[model samples]
Target chain A: MVNEVIDINEAVRAYIAQIEGLRAEIGRLDATIATLRQSLATLKSLKTLGEGKTVLVPVGSIAQVEMKVEKMDKVVVSVGQNISAELEYEEALKYIEDEIKKLLTFRLVLEQAIAELYAKIEDLIAEAQQTSEEEKAEEEENEEKAE
Target chain B: MELPPQIQAQLMQLQQLQQQLQMILMQKQSVETELKECKKALEELEKSSSDEVYKLVGGLFVKRKKEDVKKELEEKVETLELRVKTLEKQEEKLQSRLKELQEKIQKMIPTAQ
Candidate 1:
């Protein structure tokens, strides 16, 4: 009986560990989603700029240089694997939107998995408690008989 | 209660298994991320209407033929897919071993009233 309780406790620990891992994964996804949203907003605003407009383009993240917007309709977007594709403003917007959608769906799945694991942990704790209680009652009854 | 030496050994083994599993999982995640990027790039390449595409090479964007870039990305995706599968298999085996060791140790524990 004691062994069973110990095993249940161990199982609960494992479940909790898994939940922590999932939470970290979700945190990363959240950060990525935030970045994607910011990019989407920036792209939208950039699309509104008139042709030949002067804009300050950041150089090395610290200094910015005034640059002329040669073409407002086209932008180069990273397509992954270090490759960049020149895309129209509207196409780039759609790409970001699709990425955000995919990440949100993945986040939802992780959340659901965490919820299920929490339920399992609760059940395991209850089982351990009930087993311990039964053992205590049995000991008390035995003592009474002896008296 | 003192744990038997056998149970102690199993517990140590369980800990090792857990560490190995964690390492494998991290590796899988990184590879999966790369794979996702590769797939996305391929999709974008297919949809791209531009005549020129550039691949970043050591801090510089080197122009490459679209077909060549597509081929490279496709190969990378295939390799990553295989790697992820292998890591997944290792993860599954380690998990089952961990569970078995836990059960064995649990059985060895002396029952208390």
Candidate 2:
């Protein structure tokens, strides 16, 4: 009985530990969400890309569409802002998703273990009952032998 | 065993988050590339013309004397000045580009910073 109690305790401890890990993952995901929001704010500054007017390309004119690269710097800045903002959200979401996947996998294993544990408990109880019965039989045999 | 509906819902949510994050990352990468290109272009421009201002002031490095060295120099200076004007115009364009870039970045500053 003492050994059985110890087995249950160990299993319970393992389950609790797994739960703790999952909680930590949730916390991490929350932080990531905040970061994403901050990054989004920065992304707002980068809306100036591809806003240049396109010069008409004439078939016979030697004028190749000069990419009025004059505004390239502004475009770069706009895009960079977006990058910072967008990346934060991206990273946060990825992390959250990854944790969820791990959670799912871990939960599946834990559920299986819990089910198996119940079966083991039933088997243990049966064996315990049989042991008691065998002790009684031994006592009777001894008493008869003495008689 | 079948999983709980809540867990399934959570999984679906995670999928959405993953997709959103992927899209965000793509935007980030493209923006980063643009910044990098701009920096590269600026660096090249600086490298190609360190003495841009000096070049704009067309003059003889060595002093020479003639019947009218001053007038000749003045004529030469005027022609050189015209060329310098073109360079100045190009420089103006560069300055404008930088300004526009700054504006773009400024708008994004709220989210990026």
Please name the candidate that would achieve the greatest lDDT relative to the true structure: 1
* Candidate 2: tens digits of C-alpha lDDT, residues A104-139: 666566566656656665666577667668878998
Interface RMSD for candidates 1 onward, in order:
0.9, 16.1
Model 1 lDDT, residue A119, Cα? 96
lDDT of each residue in B59-97, candidate 1, tens digit only: 999988889888888898999999999999999999999
The local distance difference test score of each candidate is 0.89, 0.46
* Candidate 1 stretches greater than 4 Å from native: A60-62, B1-39, B74-113
Candidate 2 reference-contact recovery: 0.00
What TM-score does candidate 1 get on C-alpha atoms? 0.71
> What does chain B score (TM) in every candidate?
0.91, 0.41
CAPRI-style class, candidate 1: medium
